[model samples]
Target: MAASWSELMLSKLVGRCNNFFQPGSSRAMCKPFMVGDQQVGWVWPGVEKHIQRFPDVFMVEDKQVSLCPSLQMYEERTARVQEVMVKLREEGEFIALKGWRDEMYEVFHQRSSPPVFRMERTATALLGVKQYGVHVNGYVEHPQKGPLMWIGRRAKNKSTYPGKLDQVTAGGFTAGLTAQEVLVKECAEEANIPQDIALTAQPAGAISYFYEDERGLFPEIQFVFDLKLPLDFQPVNTDGEVSEFYLWDMDKVKEQIAQPDFKPNCAMVVLDFLIRHGHIHPDQEPRYLQFLENLHKTLF
Candidate 1:
């Protein structure tokens, strides 16, 4: 029998979620990247061979990768790592480093503890380190139509996910910024939203997944936010990252996410929104429980 549209959508959403969490046998082949006895990330064989050249900076042995113990201080370690990263970047070694933004991300054993060192944001992925980001789900309560969400289309020129659908406002969490700081900055920079309006965005928890691709391993967490925008408000892209915005009803948003155009991670964020707001209920969706559980995988 042909599956109904609702059933098909649920199946697709679950499939997408499953894909993001599947690291497969690739993870077993990579070496755990460690610093001060704590594993901070993973080192792929290709990157591992290159870093092995810098013996003064890295120590790869015993089926694991670690920074040289002599580089003890945080600054010292970060500087040494940066030097190796620069050499790799100049050589155009990894595809992940090509779009380097000059932004940095901290390397931590866990989210609560202090970072051991920092590395270029792009390299974090190449090394299989977890990345963090903020995603805002902007919506309005229409007097007549109920709730409507604001979605963005990535600019065609974007280096990644060009012309794909994404959240209303999103930005990666860099080395020194807090989640709220990234949230407010992205709201204004991506959507031209003012600070006062952006401040009202409430914390909407987070979603995490461990996904791998040709670029590298992505064990990522996106801190989510919900912004209740005024009915008359419109989002204009200040940055070229986003090409356009759409005010979509819940059904429309659901339908589009089922297709391939929506960025995978962003689709998970929207699915989280729908589940939290009752747009998708346990009574109707057979995969409701599984979706809630798998969307927030424990990467560590």
Candidate 2:
């Protein structure tokens, strides 16, 4: 007999949970349980007895509720019951015949399978990797003289890009989201800029770059978008991810871009956008030459 949809879903969840509990375990050992025609993971300790007595109570409940409850009460009750089952399993007290039978029935009648992806911290890396992109905007004003294009130095505690200067508002594209989606999300998270502000800004085309860090573990294909902000726009860092922010004159930025410790790809992306937008002169003296040298090394 074929497994029911609920049974299949439950089995998959249990398999994932088991693997999570015991990382590097053999697949055969962690294979989901199969009981007769039903998958084993789908059968909670006393579920069979409840089914025999209640006769399709599980099925009678709204299918949507059974899958994902919109009601808070149903969710809370289901969580409490699952927690009890987990505790009983851990204590080995459920191995007794009566305890075992009761658990099976209680699980089938009271609990709903939880989502595999909902496990905490399990999704952090996935979330981070998914949010990768390039963002570009010109600070037409000089660092100190005009409205300096504020660049934030990353906090020393950061795992990536530690102590490096980054764009005023930048973000990487994430999975299931668009470039604009990422850019807007990033601005809010990194700079606390209102979503409304981001919506009104114009997109000035993207600068693409491939980068590999010294460790070679941090490889990225970045796409930077140019965003023009109002001269009066004042940015505040709501989060401590940035240690400090400083605005430099366009000339100051050109000098900073030539520094050896500066994050190469980020500086290149910013300069590329500025040069293309006519913010920086192509035939200027020392600053223009330095910019070209940096650009040449970064691109080639």
Candidate 3:
């Protein structure tokens, strides 16, 4: 019995997703990024070398990379980090710094606690810091054809994941904003979804993963939302971030996600949706439990 395309694709997606969760070896190699006793992030080898230059601001030891304990104030710590990031950007020390937007991301020891400091958005991944984003699964339930999803094709001009398929609307959770706030903003900016309609989106929990590549480490959490649109509603790309949009049936979506064209993270969002909507059943999927476990990995 040869494996069906759906079976093969599901297996492949699970394997790809597994890669993000298996950061045991890489995590061991990276130094803990600490503030006082709390480990906020991980410092990659290259970033560790650069932070070593600023001994006054960063106290780099063999076991860990830490912000100087003397800098107690949040503003002081933020300014000090920004100074180092600016210097690195000026000297072209890191490829990630090249895309330095003025955007900031607040870094916290724990999600519920106050931020220790804020840093440039792009530098977060380079430091192996945890990043949060919102991904909305916009779909319409047709009476005859069943549920169809609205998928966005990222614009070619975008710095990352250009020309790839993505969620209908998505955006990073920036400094001082809640996940719901981001969802509303992204809904309008990315897909022209009205605020009233966007507000109706149900919170679908979250999925997290940790992965390392040549650029650096990614400890990412995507806060997922599900919005069922009216049968006649269509998503328009207001922001140039998305070039086009497609309304795909579940089978087509499954096939597309199995291919390289779809963004990996967004594919996970879709997979989670399928499972929650009873599209992917436990009786049918051999690795059902494993898939559920892989979707939500612990990351601090």
For each candidate, C-alpha RMSD in Å? 2.1, 18.2, 2.0
Ranking by TM-score: 3, 1, 2
lDDT of 1: 0.85
lDDT of 1 by residue, 191-285 (tens): 99999999999998999877776777788889999999999999999978899999999989988876789887898899899989888877777
Q: How much lDDT does each candidate structure score?
A: 0.85, 0.44, 0.85
TM-score of each: 0.94, 0.48, 0.94
In the predicted model 1, the residue pairs found to clash are none
- Model 1 ranges off by over 4 Å: 1-25
Q: List the residue pairs that clash in candidate 3.
A: none
How many residue pairs clash in model 2?
A: 22
lDDT (C-alpha) at residue 17 in model 3: 48
Model 3, stretches more than 4 Å misplaced?
1-25
Tens-digit lDDT track of model 3 for 76-141: 999998999899899997878888889999898888889999999998877788988999999999
lDDT (tens digit, per residue) of candidate 2 on 111-224: 134222111111112111111354645354434466456676777876566898878767544324566787787778777667887765566544422222121111133556
lDDT of model 2, residue 47:
32
